[model samples]
Each structure stands twice: as structure tokens, then as C-alpha cells.
Target chain A: MAKSFRDSLEAGFTITAEIPPPKSVSFPKSIEVAKKVAGKVAGLNVTDNQRGMMRMSSMAFSHILLGVGCDPVWQICCRDRNRLALQSDLLGASALGIKNVCVMTGDYPTLGDNPGAKAVYDLDAVQLMKLTDGFSNGKDIRGGVMKNHPDFFVGGVVNPFYEPIELELLKLQKKVNAGAKFFQTQPFFDIESVDTFLEQAKPSGAKMLIGVTPIKSMKMLKFLNENVLTKPIPDGVSKRIEFASDQMMEGLKISAEFINGIRDRVDGAHIMPINQVASLPLLLDMVEEGNGA
Target chain B: MVYNAPAMIITKKKDFEEILFAIGDTRSLFLLGCGDCATLCKTGGEPELKEMSQKLVAKGIAVTGTAVVPAACHELDTKRVLRKHKDEVDKAQAVLALICGAGVQSVGDNTDKPAYSGCDSLFIGNSKRQLHYYEKCSACGECVLNDTAGLCPETRCPKSLLNGPCGGAVGGKCEVNSENLCVWIDIYNRLKKAGKLENLLLKISAPKDNSGLAKPQKLELKREPGR
Candidate 1:
């Protein structure tokens, strides 16, 4: 019998892997990736147009994951949908028996393939969590009574490395107050920073899943360091990847080491093998090997 | 001493080619300008009206005449002004309004002739300097400025996130538009200065009540009964 995602979080540590739904309706690649991490992971997260590039709806793909006997964490972003559409979809997902939801304020449409598309951020992430809480209480955002309500294990994303850590902590506490059961952090390469974040975040009482992205190649490392990261990528970590003969393996090793080091300190680890789906199981194996040693 | 730019309804001139296409087959045009916001925006000022008249003439179209009305959006004032230029208005096949959409619509409402807008209504903004405008309000109906220490996250934040920064701001700059500093970060600093950081740290701004924007909204001030 499969343990519910909520149960997995409450009982002990858990590992979740993110699978980006392919743009086309026929997603053999997503299915293949899901199969690769099926039981090895505690849950599989289907990205909702990750980075605003249009893909199959997370709800639809999550149903597919459930059909394949995998616990699906359906991520919903506020960038593309209005409150009406968001509420309707949340109800629809409930009907379909999908229980886990990860709410995010998606990247702006201008950053995606369709720059001209309207960005409908009707509700920010905290508000979205509040709306979901409304559902659990048999009500809608407007205080209208709902005929049937959903029992969702709501989760949200946080950036432990975000500067002025106070602001991030405030939002984290808000998410917890808004009924977020768990949180997934943005990718981090340093344990010292995670320690600093966890020290501040522990009181919030939401299960924390520290994120680690296995840098596939030198190109990906540069893109993340230059564009995505708020702080400079640690010089020592960057140098190790830069000098390594096999950058992919070296990247995986770095992730394995980070995950192994932080295992006891955090609730779990969320491996964001960004488009490097095949490397996920191998990364997990490396973590297990380190654990054994 | 500090210099503050005038607050006005900002507009941008549409591409000349697109304007020409919209005014297709009209051989003569009465070029109209607005003296208020349009003039401040430089979209429908007297100089712009003269420049447009010259451009139309170069295209072999007849320039009937031109007027820079005090306020093209003022229906009664515009009607009186057009009546003064009755001969010019009658001779033209259509009116080309180099103003915001409201002014263009007002021109059409005042005159029987077909009126075309030469400028796209951008936003209600204040200029930082000449030709440099920034949007100060999105008119979201419900205001969150009191909680945000007067910085409007709706109009300023690219994501319009009411909680706090969305983990995208780095070095006090927005991820969507790096040229602009993140509004939430600015709000944080301002709130900190005001010793009201708890407004953000403790309060979660609810989802905006957008019912006020459900339709073309209207507000009619109640009249005094025997006035």
C-alpha cells in the first residue's frame, strides 16, 4: 500500500523528484522519467509550466502519474490563471483524487515562449494557500459555503539563499499560517547557508525539503550562477566542477555530498535535476551509497 | 529642493503605418490635439499636430485644418471647440485625434465624422522628467498602499506579489526587469524606516477584491435633492 504524501511527511523523512511535463500532449519523455523514479522517490512533482514555457497542465499530467501508481505533487502557478479558473481547477483536481498541491507565483510570461500573453496573478502565493485552506474548511475564498471541499496537502517554495533572510522568513511563516504543510527550497549548494536558514525556519513548523540541483554541465552552472542565483556561487564548489574531467558526474557527486551532509538536519531533500531527468535515480543511489559509507 | 514631474494620463503614439492603415481611403483629415494630458505626453500637443499635418500632406492627403483644444476629453468643451471650427470639421472626411482613447472617443461623440486614435492609451502615470514616465497606480480599485508604506506593489512589482519579494529580487533589483529595483524590497526598506515592518511580517494581504472591475465601472455622485 502506498503511504499518502502527507503521511510520508509526517512519519519521517521523504525524497521528492520534479518532472517537467513535456509541451506536447503525448509525453513519452515525462512518462519515462516518472517510471525511472516511481517508487524510488516518495513523491513526483509535475511542474506547472516551469519558467512560464507552456506545457501540459500540471493537473492533467498529475492524473497520468497517479494512473501509473506514483504519488503526484501538482504544482499550480498564479501567473497564467485567474482566481475563478484557479478555484475551478482546484475543485477538479480534488474530484480526480489528486491530493498534493504546490502553489507558486509563476515566472512572468515575458520570460517564456509567449511574451505577449497576459499575466493573471489574481492571487499571490500566500493568498492561494489561504484559498486552499478555505477548501479544507468547506468554503471558498469569498466565504461562500462549498458543497464539497478538498483535503489538500498544500506545499510551497522558499529560497533559503534569498538575501535579507528576514523577508524570506516572514513569507515562510505566512505560508505556514496559510496552511502550507511542507515547503521546498530553491536549489542551494552550501550547507552553512542551509544551516542558517533552518535555524530561522524551524519554528515555522512546516516540514522543510532542502533543494539540490545536480549541475549537468559547465553551461548550466554558468547560467544558474550568472542569472538565477542572488549570491555568487561559492568559489570552491565552482572550481571543483570547473576542473573535473567529468563535469556531469562531478555535479552529481556535489549533490550527493550536500544531500548526505544535510540529511539529519532537514526534513528531507528535493532533487531538482532540471531537465536532466535520467540522472535522478543515479543521484539517489549516490546518496544511498554515501549513507552506507 | 526637488523637481517633480507633472502627473498626467500617459499615451504612446501608434506606429505611423498603423495609423495610416486605420485611416485608409480618407483623403482629408482634421488633426485634433489635447492641451492637457496629451500635451504633457507630447502625443497630441500643437507641435505634434503640426508634424502630423505635414506627414499626411507628404502622403498626398489633404490637411483640412488643426486645433489644440484645451481638453479633448472634456465632451462639452470639445463640442464647443469643434463648433468654432465647423467649416474645417465639415470639409474633412474624418478626424485624427492624437490623444488618449478617451479624447478620441470624445471627438467621435462630438462630431458626426469618423474619428481615429493616433495614440495608444498607456497608463495614468507621472513623469520623472521630460519624456520619462513611470506608472504610479494600476487602479486595481482596492488600495494596499497603507499596509505597504505607500509603495504600490500592484503597479510596481512585476509579479504584483502582495506578500513579499518572490525570491527573484537580487541586489535590490527585480528579476523580470533588472533595470528597476524590486518594489517589495523598496517597501521593506520604507516600512523598516517607518518602524512598521510588522505590516508585512505579520499581515498577509488577502486576494484583491476585483468585483469593482467586473464591468465598465461607473460612479455617480449623489445630487443634493433640491439644488
Candidate 2:
């Protein structure tokens, strides 16, 4: 029997890595990286034209990963395609045996390589989730048409640290109503902030997968805290990275330990390493075997 | 492309309130912002312009009528806005340009009443920075992007030379121009490199309806849902 999503997560701590697509078709670095994490991790995510940079399309690249024995989660963003394109892509992905999907609203193109390129936001992430579920029920978003549709185990993203967590939770409810099966969040270096988000979002009844990317040093912690959104490295998490003689190992240990701590709080942990995707297998091993959380 | 660059067409509550104060007791005014071109320009979308006309009511001017019609320049849209407000516009001391020339004149065509340009008519251009401006597309009698590798010859090229490679394009630097690409040279090398020298030989469509000359052109995009 084909493995189900619940079973896939139950096979132990689910570790997913994000592999960004290359700038163009001529580049092979992205493909090379996808193959690197095939059997070692649970699934590899292929981002479509991340940050709006033109790349070999995500559909083609995710199929490439599937060919290499890796389960790929294709990110379908609404920044490029309309409802027709978005629904068509979702239905097509199901035919190709790509089951997992991560829905994002996508960053503006003005923040991307081609700022001059037009951005087509047919539906936002929450709206898209609802749109797809409606399709599965043999209905359209506007309830005007009915057609063949495929079942998608769609995922949504949230930042636990966004100010006014209440508002974010309200949006999360809408996303769940749209038919999100699972949710993988932005990083949670600060357990306190994430814990607050968990309290607010726990009611959505989604299979929650909290993100836990460990830091390397005090400097790295500060950079993420100040520069990145809703990702502040708490003092306790920072101290683990600060005292280690080997920074990289310390980062893995801290990340693994953090995931183990809240292992009961959320269903899975998506280990996102800025450069350390290769460290994922070892990190998961530590999470399952270690006594520390 | 992506019009992500933000502009402030909205006056703050304080500023707009003050505008109401300035026009106190002014009545029977015709305030028209173009429905089509101004909508595209983002200066006066129908929603905001409607709000503006509605707000003008406090000063005794009730813009009870509004027309979100096509091309303020087109006699159709202009006539609609004016005729709908004619009694009001005729009774009023002034008519307002919610749109560009085509709209203002449409109102002016029937009345000896004064017309005001509420929003400045900025020629088709791009904002250089927040609140900063620069002219880009001049609607020169030609569009040379096809030959110039998607760059316009009149605006970007130093000399507006259609055929010859301008010397200003040395090392990709425009001679008389500061940092912008030299249009003709870009065209010459682009066509030559793309093996499309014949495309450069092909004449381009002459710029038309620019300078607000002649009548305004109309564009309609129909989206039949679920197609």
C-alpha cells in the first residue's frame, strides 16, 4: 500500500528540507542538492521561482526529485498564476504522484531578481486553501463551475512570532476552513513566542509541524532576531549554541534538542538549514535517540 | 511590470478634512476624475474619486451624480459626467478635472464655466523615488523597443537615432546620457546579435493619441469567468 501522510509522520520525527530552484534551466545545482537528501530525510520541498526569480519551473524539478527516490513537496504560490493555473497545477501534481504541497502568498517581485516582472496574485494562501477544497467538493471558488478535481494534502505556513498573534490565528482558522491538512511554520528559535502561537493556532485541528532551525553563535542569533521576522533566539537556546566548542555540531544539537522538547506539542519538525540540509539525517537521529528536549 | 512601488493618492484624514474646510460653502460643483486612464494611472480610481465627490457635499457641493465611464477624453464619458451634473455644473462656478484633458474639455465643451485640473497631468513616466519624479516614455512618434531590444530609442538613446549606432553607447555607456543605456546602439547590437537585422529594417508603428492629441483611445478587457 502507498504510505499515507499520517503514517509518514508516524515513522518517527518528520524532517523536511527546502531546496530552492535554480535561476535558470541551465543551472543544475538545485537538482544536485535535491538528490542529496533523498532517503535520508522524510521529504524534500521544491520552491517555485522562490522570491520571484525565474527558474526552471517547480513542477518539472519536483518530478526530477521524485525520480531520484525523494518525496518532493511542491510549493504552489499565487504570485505568478491565477485560479485556473493554480487549480490546474494542483490537479496535475496529483496525477504525477506528488502528494504534499506548501501554500505561500509569496514575496513581492519588487523584492526579487526581476522587480520589473508583473506579479499575478490570483488568490492569497488562505483563499487558495479554500479554493482547492471547494474544487475537491466539485465546486468552484465563485460556485459557478464544476469539474474533475484531485485530493490534495495541502499545507499552510505561519509565523508564530508575528505581532498580534490573535489576528494570525483568525487567518489560520480561515486556512483550515480552506482544507489545510498540515501546517509547517516559520522558524521557532524562541519557544516562548512559538508557544503563544501554538495556543492560538492549536484550535485549527491541523496536523501541526513546528519549524526548529538551530543557531550557530550569539552573532547568528542576534542577526536572525533583528533582521528576520518573528524569529528571536531565546536566551536558553542561544546559550546552548554560545558555549559549544564546535559551532556547527552545537547548532545541530540545539536544534535537535529543541524539537525533542516540544515533540509532544506539535506533530512534526521541519529542519530548515540555511546551508546544512545534509545535517538533517543526523539531526533526526539525535531527536529520536536523545533524552533531552 | 509589477506596480509594487507604492504611491500616496490618499490624503490623510487631516489633510482631506482641511480640503473640505478650504472649499467651505462651495456648491453645485462638477468634480470628475477620469474613469479609464486615471483609473489605470492610480491617481483617481472610481472608488476614491467617488468618495472625494461625496465628501465635497459638506461644503454645500453635492456630487450626487458620478459616472465611472471610459476615457474621460472620450465625448461619451465626458458628456455623461457633464450632462449628469450639467444643472449642478452649470449652476456651479467651476468644473473639476477628475480626469485628464479629454475629460476637462468634455465638461468645458458645453459650458462657459471654469474648469480646474485637480490632479496634475504627469506625462506617462515612472517615479524615481518616493515623491521624486522623472519622465520615461515620451510617446515620441515611434516605439523602437522591437529593434532596440525592448529599449526605446527616443527616450533612452542619446540622439534618438533610429538607424545608426550612436557613439554614446561606448562600453554600454550613453555619451550625452548619464547612466541609462544608449537606445540606438542597444538596437543595433541587439538586432545584429539576434540575427534579426531585418526586424530593425521593418518600420515601427508611429506613436498615436499621445500628447492627448486627437481623441482618446478606448481599451476594454473582458474576463468571462470559469473560462
Candidate 3:
């Protein structure tokens, strides 16, 4: 059996992958993808309506992954639920034996299908982590004691590419103080660009996992460059995929190379497949082979 | 009675068709407008009242009468204004208020007939000039203006982030609405200028206690028994 996600983090080098839950009720395909990368990664993180698009609740999907013997990182966000619902969901996740959680202030509601939906950001990311910390101490947010409280491994996100990088570093410090055990950063393709962020963050003593998403085509590269990334994709990285005969394989190679370059600098890598979950096992193999060479 | 207060209670007119649909079967209508905030917004002024009255007349609905209340949000003032036009108020089946939410409710509370709002209450704002306004406060019930160097993240930042700026800001502009500068960055600069950056860096804001946002908020000032 795979080591628990906490053990993997403490062991120094770890690998995790994020799988978005399905939009529809059925999740056989998601389970199958989780099974494929079961032993290959330290944990599988199921996203909570990533990009503001509604999907199956990450809690339900993570529970399913846990049942299949995969360590599941249940991601919870503050966009849809107020504090009451957030607290209730945390207790529910604990009752269901979902041990690891990644907290975020999810994408705004208008970015996805439901532009008319109201956003409820009652608690930001740091506050959510603080709430999770409260759970581990057997105290609810109101200071009332519960008969049995949850023991959770809490995590948060950082955006290394965000300019005024001081702002990002400050939030990183806050998250660390709020009891974030580890962090998964926003997708970064270059290692050197984030060195300043890593240097500033090292004092916090929180484990850092660099986020990587393997691009499958030119169109995706363009979309991410224009709409997603704060800093545009490095010209060299973009050109390699743009000019490649087989862009998919080239994209996989770029991700592996990027991971291999940063593995020694950071704690580990978080592979966000971006709807390409089936390619994860193969991508992991490529990274391993490159490290061996 | 002269003051330099920015402004309050900005409102915008809803589509005429929607208003028409809302007042179905009410052939006779009494139009009510506010002389202060709504008049400044141009949605409820003498011209707008006359324009609305004409539109209703063109729609084959009788215009019973119209009055611009000096302060429609004041319940007593609204009642006094309606009394001046009691004959018109009795002839009209319903009262259509072209003012802010508080003004509409005041009219509703003071009248027996159905009351409908002809405008959407936007936000408490500053009038840069006539017909040009910008939202200044969201009335979140808790103010953080001191920490932010006098800029309101609650009213300005789309995310209402308390700790700091989110990752989406680029070129000091917000990702949600690119036209607006990221208020946090502005706050940071202001704090740096004010030599209070350490306070922001050192403190982690607790989650807001939103209980104050509970609906139907009421306030009753205690007073001496015999003043």
C-alpha cells in the first residue's frame, strides 16, 4: 500500500496529481483514471468545481477514490459555501475518512457556466486553513468542544508567477502561520523564474510542490498564455511545443524536463493534468526515466 | 445647511417594459420621485416624472398625478407628501416609485395601494458630476478602511480579499474587471506612503463576522424618558 500523504511529505520528495471531478453524476471514468495513477503518485487531488464550473462535489469523488485504495486530497473552496456549510463539509469529510484537504479561494462565479450565481467568499484561503487547524485541535470555530474531532493534513496554493511577488510571499507567510503543512503552486513552466519566490518562502518551513500542466496542443498554449497565466509562457517553452511534429509528446517532454530541473530545488511536483488524466501514468514514467538518466 | 458629503443612494431606471408588466391592470398610476438622491441620479427628477407620465399616458393608462417627495426615504416626509395629493392618491390603483429601495419601502409603508419600484437601487456612491457616479461603500457592516489606508477592499476589490491581493492582478489591474486598478495594490502603495506596511504584513485578518448582514436590520436609539 502507498504511504499516507503526510508521510510522503515528510519523506522529502513527493508527487501528486489533481483530477477534476465529473460534471455529471457518473464518475466511472474518473475512478479509472485514479486507479491508473494510484501507486504512481503520493496522492490524487480531486478539484472542487475548478474554474468555477460546477462538477460533482470533490468530497464525494475523493471518497470514491479513497474506497479504491488511492490517497485522496479533497480540495474545498470558499466560493459556493458560507462558513456554516464550509464547517459542515469539513466534518463530513472527516467522518468519511478523507484525510487530506487542499483549500483555495476558488475562481469567480462568472468565469464559468453560471454567471448569474452569487459568490460567497465568506472566508478567504488563509481563514479556511485556520478553520482546518481548529478542527485538528478538537475545537470548533466557536470554541465549543466536540466528542470526536477531525485530524486533517491541510494545504494551500501559491501563485509563483504573480508579479508584485511580494504580495504572494506575504500571503504565503500568512498561510504558513495559519497551519498550512504544504503548498501546491499555480502552474509554472520555468524553474529559474520562481527562484526568488522559493528563496523568500523557504523561511516559512512549509513544503512546496511546484505545479506543472503538460500542454496537449498549440491552441491550449495560446489560451493559457492569454487568459490564464499572469506571466506569459516563456517564449522558448512555447516555441518548442509550437514547432514540434508531435505536440502532445513534446508537451509531455517539456513537463518532465521542467519537473526534473526543479525536483532538487523544491520538495516535489504536483501534476495538474487539466482534463488529461489518462496521460498521468505515462508522464510520471517519463519523469522517472529522465531522473535516472 | 451646507455640507460637502459625497452623495448617497444611487439608482438606475429599470426597463419600461418590465415596469409596465409589473403594474398590470392598474390603468391609473401615481408617480412618486425623490428630490435628493434620485433627482441627482436623473432617474427620478421633474423631467423623468414628466417623461414617465407621458409614457404611461401613451400606453393608454391614465396618469392620476405625480409628486416629487422632498425626501422619499423619510417615512414621515413620504406620508406628508402623499397627503398633499390625497385626491390623486385615491384615484390611482398603485404608486410607482422612481427612487432607491428605502424610498420605495417608505412609499409602500405609507400607502394602502400596491407600490412598485421603477428603478434598481445600485449603491451608495460619490457623484463625480451630474449623471456620473462611482460606488464608494458596500455597507458591509464592518469597516476596514483604517487598515487599508482609507481605500475599501470590500467595496472596491471584486474578491473582497482581506489579507492581500489575489494572483489574478496584472499590470496593477484586476482580472475580473480590467478597467479597474487592483485596489489591494493601491492600498499597498498608500500604506507604503503612510509608513504602515508592517501592520498589513504582520496581521492576519480573521474571517468577517457577517451576522450583522442579517436581513431586516433595525436600529432604535435609546433616549431619555423626558427630553
**DockQ for all models, in order?**
0.73, 0.02, 0.65
Model 1 chain A TM-score equals: 0.95
Query: Could you tell me the C-alpha RMSD of candidate 3 in Å?
Result: 2.0
Task: Return the TM-score for each candidate structure.
Answer: 0.96, 0.57, 0.95
Q: Model 2 misses residue A123 by how many Å?
A: 1.7
Q: Which candidate would rank higher by DockQ, 1 or 2?
A: 1
Which stretches in model 3 have alpha-carbon errors above 4 Å?
A: A291-293, B1-6, B223-227
For each candidate, the alpha-carbon lDDT, in order, equals 0.86, 0.63, 0.87
In the predicted model 3, the residue pairs found to clash are none
At residue A227, what lDDT does model 3 achieve? 80
| TM-score between predicted and true chain B, model 2 | 0.55
Model 3 chain A is weakest, by summed lDDT over 10 consecutive residues, at A161-170
Candidate 1 lands at a TM-score of: 0.96
Candidates in descending DockQ order = 1, 3, 2
lDDT per residue as tens, model 2, A1-293: 23444457756556676776665666465555555556556777788787567787788777777887788878888678876788888778878888777887676576568878666654556667767666666776567667666666678777565433433454566567667877778788756665777777878887777877767666777887765544446677677777779877888887877777776666777767765655666676677687375
